[model samples]
Target chain A: MSTPDPRLSINQGTLKYADLATALRATAEAGVQAIGLWREPVQEVGLATAARMLTDSGLRFSTHCRSGFFTMPEGPARRASIEDNRVAIEEAATLAAAGAAGSTAVLVIVAGGLPQGSRDLIGARERVRDAIGELAPDAAAAGVTLSIEPLHPMYASDRCVVSTLGQALDIAADFDPAVVGVTVDTFHIWWDPDVLASIERAGREGRIATYQVCDWKTPLPADVLLGRHYPGDGVIDFGPMTRAVMASGYDRDIEVELFNEDIWATAPLEAVRRTAAGFEVAVSPYLTE
Target chain B: MSTPDPRLSINQGTLKYADLATALRATAEAGVQAIGLWREPVQEVGLATAARMLTDSGLRFSTHCRSGFFTMPEGPARRASIEDNRVAIEEAATLAAAGAAGSTAVLVIVAGGLPQGSRDLIGARERVRDAIGELAPDAAAAGVTLSIEPLHPMYASDRCVVSTLGQALDIAADFDPAVVGVTVDTFHIWWDPDVLASIERAGREGRIATYQVCDWKTPLPADVLLGRHYPGDGVIDFGPMTRAVMASGYDRDIEVELFNEDIWATAPLEAVRRTAAGFEVAVSPYLTE
Candidate 1:
């Protein structure tokens, strides 16, 4: 068995605007251990076709990009969102069944901002919890572990309402450990004061399912939706973060996911290769034997 | 006594590069109840001169812009930073003595980010705590309650390492309640999952000293070194935040502090007046009689 570096996984978002086949080929060629596939790319090539390519290229599957949006106001829209996430879970299971290494774990959630005409953040959070509770069963039956990805608090309004690791674990603790888990992204949770403690708790509880890496830039623009730096380029100190994750006993893939205009503007192959190199350099100190 | 609208106050940053006296005069003319002053302006015109003008215009002093840099890594720089903050506390005391209405508090805290080659965030936080511990005595003696302003998590690196209300309060809890308190700026703490709970706790403990407001925009530009947006123009759900602060028993002035380049580029007076108006409209619902 080849002992590859688990810290070098590719998140499809790094090459989001690029063609799926082209992106996958580039990722495989770059020697990344795994890739986090998104729904859009799978839809583009058809799931079976994409599965065949991954099979051919020997690319391992990291957690899928997402599967949660259960916070919409009660109505058809909410039901539709839940159904869509179910489909994502099913897709993850399909990939697992098709010989991708590791369990079929779906990066289960992103926060949806406050509903129209609503001024209650607590109510919004309750809605998120209720929505996830509703989806946990279907996810479990499909042999998929729902990994709640707590986004940066900056996205608390429009994106994931799950803004901290502690909050995510609280939600996960409500469900069976095998059904619900937490995915720790360095960019999102690095600023959290209780992150290290929370990670330790999650690890002890066996809730950590995946790990992601990205950088936080300084003088961040007032608009954060599109602002993200490549790992090691920004201010987030990942040394302690890596040590904390490793301490969590989570020997999972560390996916590199950046959302910067500058990196996105470059050629897809070059971006993937550059990201792999950056990842190696950024996390080299924390890499365990 | 003319009862000023407590909800409408101006933070000097909204004016960007405008002259402080000019901005203050315009804010008073615009009928704003109070203004949050910065050190540069107070230094430029001399605190005594600035105080005299506020006395002449009958403008309320809501809070001083800042007085903390307690997070500097060991050495003369850290000591020098704390000394500078002490001067700011003295400046706030000067403003209070100059006939400005209400409790005058100076924001005291630390500079965040990797100090030189230090990659340990937890260690940085400890340094910040120690710095605060060191400054509390001087602040209390000056009759200036150093308000610890918890900046947004995005600023966890280079700005203020204190990124949440809970974290700020935790540090404050270690000091004499009369000496250290917490400042709640909507721009900074709105994204926190536990914001409401933390605010409530602050109120229960009488730690809620200063409050400010602004909005968060998505797709934010990479360069935020300039300024952000006015209260109502961005994506943040200010209504919930306003209610949360009010519910926390914070009956103090709610200052409007926007770091927006667009607003700053305009005449300083114009920016203050416009922001004051925006504050009235955006936060009117939560204002108590």
Candidate 2:
């Protein structure tokens, strides 16, 4: 097989079934230089041990997979979510420090869906802004950048209220870009008519914390969440988006975060290799040489 | 049941299996005041017979439901789609003339998806603008308003490229408002952060040809196309959207164009009644008194 792209980072969720040691081993064994970790596996081994294992793997940590479903109103649920996010902030900082020198202390945040049985979308959105406000200081204190991710609109009512990069940036605006920014994932925003402009704005505003690549296709699977494909495997034309992100002065490892069932069913090492291959073809062409 | 909202129009798609005669009869029997029709059922009876039936039903015609899937490059298919749209425009005019006073000759347009195997969304969208340019004169001559309907972004790949009201209005900007307008549908755009602004803009530009309502719920059915629900059955708060459209000075009949499997399985008249009931609770309160 050809050499993997140096800038390709394997997002852990792509290896959905892999445990921490296997995930790290497979990604590193595949000759991939970086991996983004999810909370479950990190907590499975505990933070310090997970960080030490990550260091032994000799790979960079691109980001902490996620932890920001705090779109609930003030109450027990909201308090629990807030406390969890604080822990996530610390996790991100610890992992970033334990990984290779270039690791970034960024925690991707998915603003939760509408509270159960509530049709108050406007209210739900306001709460996301408020939740971020509550979490910003904690993130800053932990030395972690909380990256708000704008999920696909299909997930608006059930998974996330933040459904656009511009919206994410708007919430991120009140905080330091170093503490709170946005996650630009092609799978979620590729269909946006104003995506290129939004990317430029995110850059101008210095709010792009991470740039993740994936592909989107229709006749989406039974579970829409698992419909994301390897970068070159679907209809997404990565050229313009990749070029736009690069032109916006974003210089960082691009994570391939496929959530497809087929990919997860494959061996983690194979998945990483395939992800690297797809990224090289679909996204690498637009990067600055 | 309570008297149907006078402004509520049962979009024929809500009765997916109903022939033109049955759809007209069911809607009129439901005490609904108007309807928007699909070309298939209209053409099934032939336009003249359909127009006569509509006149007999005594319901206002809200929009022609719909015909504008010409997002391909120069080819025979594109030519056929354009010719078909011209026919659709003529039908909209004839039906509008035949319906009771206050009927609108608005032909709803759904810009087709990406050409098979092509990822040129920008190009596909441009072709929609170009196709509108080509069809504008025919529409104007026929006294028909071609209303561009931006389908939800989920349909961007295999259904419609126009995914936001703002984008639709931008395309309509080049033509006279009377000839080129937009269809504002709640189910398609309720999640948009800029939906309220787009609705206001559509009104400011005199481009809102039709206002359609339906609800969006989670765990979208296998065929995402059929996941639409009766307005109040899902989490979409139609209040703001309905209010914005009304405040935009849209005085036309409001169409409830649901595309759901279970609803379609119900009796057509019952489905219309349910739709009316849903709209009364979800949207009617937001209408100008």
Best prediction by lDDT: 2
| Model 1 misplaced regions, further than 4 Å | A1-7, A115-120, A219-230, A265-270, A284-289, B1-7, B101-103, B108-110, B217-222, B225-249, B265-273
Give, for candidate 2 chain A, the lowest lDDT window spanning 10 residues.
A280-289
Instruction: State each candidate's chain A TM-score.
Output: 0.93, 0.99
Kindly list the per-residue Cα lDDT of model 1 for residues B225-259, writing each as its tens digit: 44367777765667766777787777777787776
iRMSD in angstroms, per model:
3.3, 0.7
Please report, as a residue range, the 10-residue window in candidate 1 chain A with the lowest summed lDDT.
A1-10
Question: Could you give candidate 1's per-residue lDDT for residues A254-282 as a string of tens digits?
Answer: 88887877778888878887887677668
Error of 1 at A67 (Å): 2.9
State which candidate has the highest DockQ. Answer: 2
Q: For residues A1-289, write the lDDT of model 2, one tens digit per residue.
A: 8888888899999999999999999998989999999999999999999999999999999999789888788999999999998999999999999999789999999999999999998899999989889989998888899999999999999999999998998888888999999999999999999999999999998888999999999789988888999988889999988888888888788898888889989988889888988988898888954
